[model samples]
Target: MKKRKLVMGTFGGLLLLFGAVTGFQTLTLESRQPAAKPTSVEIDKDKALQHLSEAITYQTISYEDRTKFDFSEFDRFIEFLQNSYPSIHEELALERINNYALLYKWEGTDSSLNPIGLTSHYDVVPVLKGTEENWEQEPFSGTVTEDAIWGRGTLDDKIGVIGIMEAVEYLIQEGYQPKRDMYFMFGFDEEIGGEEGAKAIAETLKNRGIRFDFVMDEGGAIVENMVPGVSQPVGVVGVSEKGSATVELTIEGSGGHSSQPKDQTNIGRIAKAISKLEETQFHAELRGPGEDLFEFVAPEMNLGMKYVFANKAIFKPVIEHILLQEPASAALIRTTIAPTIFQAGEQSNVLPEKATAIINLRLMPGDSLEEVKSFIEKTIDDKQISVSISGSEATKVSSVDGWEFSTIQQAARNVYGNAVIAPYLMVAGSDAKHYDDVSNNTYRFLPVQITAEDLNRMHGTNEHVSIDNYLNSIKFYAELIKEANK
Candidate 1:
């Protein structure tokens, strides 16, 4: 009886200690959001809206086939910038890389500091051939209503180009100068890949021995409901971008009449391989930027969520499991596999001798192509099947502890005072990745409040930005310049 009583007391004591530890962690978890002093500058509302609308009228679309690109439209875009912002053209020294990418250097009073760069791609994706009719406004019409500016490129990045240009023009008019040099780098072919546009600019500056203090580009936006626990709108900055890679699986075997086919044919083998891959997907581990994301947001979340996240040492496995349930959350934790193309039998009757499948992957940081290939080979476990992989690895993670991030965070908060700005891993490819070597740290964040629907509209039909969102984006750029130099 005495032994039983002792065991009960010991169990109660352990539970008390556990609760005490978790409670202390929860109470100590503090908000990482910088104390943003809200400030506003009067930007011409009518003129700003008009400028973005007019900028969208020019169709600078990127095509997969080089021959389909209309360079004349790009020419018009360059002309439009010249006519729209005269002071920017005359005051800042400009160079056109590859006759398309624009690089503007704004010299500062202090030569001791390294220059900063603001980059965005002006090129927009081509509207699908048949999907044009799906748009509420014409795909490239640059439609302006009472509340919004309707067109392509408004969200994907033309807003970024025009926003930066407009902000500089405003500052120039105000006779403001910076202590550190600033470069406005705009790429033309980011939609397809920035090979010709962003790549050339990085190469040009690299050969000249010019290194940036930090380079900012268009990426993650401010959105609500992005994380399950947090209620306020969260603005995520891309500290690192996941590498995009292509992996292909192929099988070749003997072919015969369909009537006398063996139990395992080429199509059957490839399909079985795909099934195995799906069943044994990439292992999910919540570390790196994904872990950082929760750390910053934990303090802002409700008590229940804060309790779970604050005691991460004990609740990490539970948190990872919960995160793995959602597709977007799962992406933050692991590499993803998407089967894009599958080719098996051409004709219905004859058994095919060859089968091939192509998969598109977004790799997490520290995951190499070679390791990915080995995992695929092991998972499939079929000697008859051959696997091939190709693509770049993930970009190096940037530091959130530096002024580079705090400047962006502060600027974003100056305009969006109520938001929770946090660092996250970008799942898509952008021009920022090309400048990885040229700059010590590269950051990607498009300053706009967007929704889940707005994400689809970016490269899809009916892409548009609300007039207020458009205006606020300009404010962000203007504030970013002021914050960076200060």
Candidate 2:
């Protein structure tokens, strides 16, 4: 009876210690809010909307096969920009790279300060052939309905292009002079790898020995219900983008009739290899940008979630396991494996001599392509299957505790007073990656509030943006300019 009582007392003491640790963590959490000095810049809503609508009419579609591009449309779009913003053309020095990409320099009073860059792609993905009729309006009509503007490029990017132009024009009208040099770069072929557009532009600037303080591009945006615990809409700024690699697994061996097949066939081996890879995925651990995301949001989480995240040192494995259950969340902490294409025999009775499978991988910030290849070779553990990998490595992680990031957060908070602004990792590729060599830091964010459904419309049918969202985007750009210069 005395031993039983001692065991119970020890158990109760352990529970009390756990509770005390969690309570202390929650109380000591830091606030993410920054002092915001927003601009009172008034935008001409009607004019900005008209510019976006008209800009959409020109189908600046990018195709993998460059010969299919209609240069006439590109020429017309350039003409429209020249006519639309006279002040920009008159004051800023404009240079055209590769005959289509635009580079504009807005010289500041102080050349001592490093330049700032604002980049956006004008080229858009081609609308699926048969899905054009499914749209609420014609894909290229650029129709402005009652509340929303309907078109292809409205949300994907044209918003960024027009929004920046409108803000600069408004600032020019308000006689607001910047203290730092500003560069507005528009890429013509971002949808198709950006090799000729942004990549070439970055090379040009690097050769000139020019460097920038920071470069802002279109990426993450404000969304509701994105973070688990935060009730307010969170505005995510992407500090690093995941690397993309295409790994091909191929097997070449003898082919025979299905009726008299060998004990092991090419198809069976490839299938087994893929199965093994799916079953044994890359290790999932909470670190780098993924950990930073939770750290920023933990303080704002409810008591229950706050307790778990605040004590992350002890609960990291549990949190990672929970996050790994969802595909979207799993991508945050580990390299993703997706089998995209498989090519094999054409006839049912005959086995093909060669079978090939293509796997697309989105690598974590610190993961190298060579390491990914090694993992696959080790995981499959088959000498017969030839493995080949090629792609870019993950971008360098940017600083979150610096004034540069604080300026962006402050601008977003100043405009979106209710939003919880935080830094995150981007899973997809963007033009921002091209500027990494030319700038000290590159940030990816599009100043707009969108729902999950709206996100789908970026490259899908019925793409649209509301009038209020577009206007707010312009205000954000204008306010960001002021904030960064200050």
Candidate 3:
């Protein structure tokens, strides 16, 4: 009888302890929200859609081989813009760089304030020859259906170019004047790396001592079911981008007949090195913009998830374990390793004299190139297998707590009501990085709400955008401009 009584009491105590722990976690998750209300501005729908459709018809495609690019299409696109937005041409000072790239300055009433810039690329990736038949409409047709507008550049960034122009044109029509200076930079060759386009523009502006308050570029968007626990649509604004690095592992000087092969051949050494790298990946830690994502979503999550995330200080390992289960989430925490190419024996019977493997790495911020190289050398622990690593370092992280970021979030929320706006790290590169030297803060966000299919279409077949989304994106830009000027 005493044993039974003690067991009952112990079970009750355990339940109470679990409840207490869970309650503490829930409280922690409920603490992230902005202090100010995001303001919204009205946008013209029909005009924005018309502009987007017209913007897509030009095959302003970027080619890695500069000579292959048809500058004639770019010239036609420029002529179209001149005809499309007469108000902008009459007001803003337009300058052409390299006869392809463009920069426009809208002088504000208050010249004392540093300007805010909006940027997007005009070039689209060439539609693969065989894949063109898969598109719902011609890649450059710019079809406008009742439900959606179809084309190549609609989603990737013609939306940005046309959206900004539509907003500015509308603002001019409305007689709305901005207090701070505004600059619009359009890159001609962002796809093949913006060396002659965005980089050149940045150098020119930097030389002129034109420092900006902040710069906005195309990146993260409002997406559904992106967060595991949150039900609200999450609008992610990118504050930093991961660096891309390629590591080549090569081994040479081993050859023999299949029957007379050594205990360890060139291929064997290369394989072992690759296996080691895969087994020992970079350490995964929850910090920076990744941490910021959870901070915003946890409070809105269910009780069970909220509890776990709220007490992340104590349950960090558990949260990381859950996150590591997903490749998308896993990428946020650590540098990834992908073996893209491998070369070994040419003939099946004979042992190879040399072997090589190429590893693609997306480095986390603060992880230096030299440090990563040293770590790889130590991990493989093979002196004979030489490893060479090279790539650009990660971009500097921007401040999410500052007014510039908050204003961006606020503007997005006002335009995309019911969506939870949050800051995160971007995995891909953007022209926003080029302006890092001049701007105090650089944010990457394209305020269009989209589905998983839409994401696939951004760089794939059936690329498109709804007429409503196009207009909404323009409204977002106008609202953002108005909010920042205040």
Candidate 4:
């Protein structure tokens, strides 16, 4: 009886100790207060809005098949930019790569400081054929409704391109010159992969021995109700984008008639292999940018959430388990596996001789292609099934503690006073990944406030941006330019 009482007492004491530690950690957590807003810079609201609206009218679409591209549209878009932003075209040294991608250099007085690059893709994804009528306004109309500018490219990116130009033009008009050189790079083929646009530009800059202090590109945005515990909107800047890999699993074996099939057919083996992979997924752990995201948001969380995140050393497994519950949240912590394509029997009655499946994976920062391939082989434990994997590894993580990040955070805060600016991992790929080699730090952020629905419009039908969001994006770019110089 005494031993039982002692064990209970010790367990209760341990629980109390844990509670005390959690409370202490929560109390000691750092506060994330909004920075003081910068002085407002006035821009021609009508002129800026008109430029974005008009920019969308030129159908500068990027198609996967190079043959399908209308080069005339790209030419018209370039001509439009030159005509609209004459100050930028006249002042900045412009270079065209492969006859499409644009590079504009705004020379700074100080050569000792490394130049900064601002990049975005003007090329918009094509509106799916059948979904054209689904749009409230014509997809290529560039309609200016009472509240929003409706069309393609308003959200996915042309905002970045036009917004940057408007900011630079405004700054030039105001006689504001950067202390450090600034470069504006616009890619023409980001949708299909930047191989012909951003990739080639990076190589060109590399060959010239030119490097940048930091490169900012379009990515995460200010999202309301995104982080559960935080009351204010959170502006997530992607410090590193996840790597993408395509793994092909193939099984080949003897064929047979439908009635006289082998006990283990090719299709059966391939299906079983896929099932094994689905059942045994990559382990989920909160580290790297994922952990950094929580760290920044935890201070603003409610006491219950703050307690868990504050005591992450003890509650890591619990947090990870909770994150793993949702597909969107689960993707943040670990490498994700998605079986995108499958092929088996040619006919329903025939027993196929071969089966193939393609699994698309977004790799976490530390996970590599070789490791993923080996994992597939080990998980399925089927020598007969051959696996091949190919893709880029996750880009090197950038410095969140440096001035480069602080400048971005401060600039965002300056424009969005109520937002909680935080660092995060980008699950989707972006053009910024190509600039990783040319810049010391590559930070991805699209300075606009967007809702969950706005996110869906990026690559979908009826994409549009509110006038307020568009204006705020312009202010953010201008502020970022000033902040970079500071």
Q: Identify the leading candidate in terms of TM-score.
A: 1
Cα lDDT for residue 54, model 3?
A: 82
lDDT (C-alpha, whole model) for all candidates: 0.93, 0.92, 0.87, 0.92
**Best-matching candidate per lDDT:** 1
Number of clashes found in candidate 3? 0
Screening candidate 4 with a backbone cut-off below 3 angstroms (N, C-alpha, C), the clashing residue pairs are: none
Candidate 4 lDDT, 56-144, residue by residue in tens: 99899998899999999999999999999999988999999989999999999999999999999999999998998799999888889
- Per-residue lDDT tens digits of candidate 1, residues 55-130? 8999999998979999999999999999999999999999999999999999999989999999999999988899
Write the number of the candidate with greater lDDT, choosing between 1 and 2: 1
Query: By TM-score, how accurate is candidate 1?
Result: 0.99
For model 1, which pairs clash? Answer: none
Candidate scoring better on TM-score of 3 and 4: 4
Can you write out model 3's per-residue Cα lDDT over 164-203, one digit (the tens) per residue?
A: 8888888888888899999999998888888888888888
In model 4, the Cα lDDT at residue 115 comes to 95
In model 3, which range of ten residues has the least summed lDDT? 30-39
Q: CA lDDT of 55 in candidate 2?
A: 95
Model 2 / residue 65 / CA error / Å? 0.4
TM-scores, one per candidate: 0.99, 0.98, 0.94, 0.97
> lDDT per residue, candidate 2, 1-486, as tens digits?
999999999999999998898889888988776755565778887888899999999989999999999989999999999999998898889999999999999999999999999999899999999998899899999999899999989998989999999999889888889999999999999999899999999999999988999999999999999989889888889999999999999999999898999887998899899999999999899988888888888888888888889999988999999999899899999999999999999999998899999999999988999999999999999999999999988998888888888888988888888888888989998999999999999999999999999999999999999888899899999988988899
Candidate 4, superposed: residue stretches over 4 Å from native: 1-13, 32-34
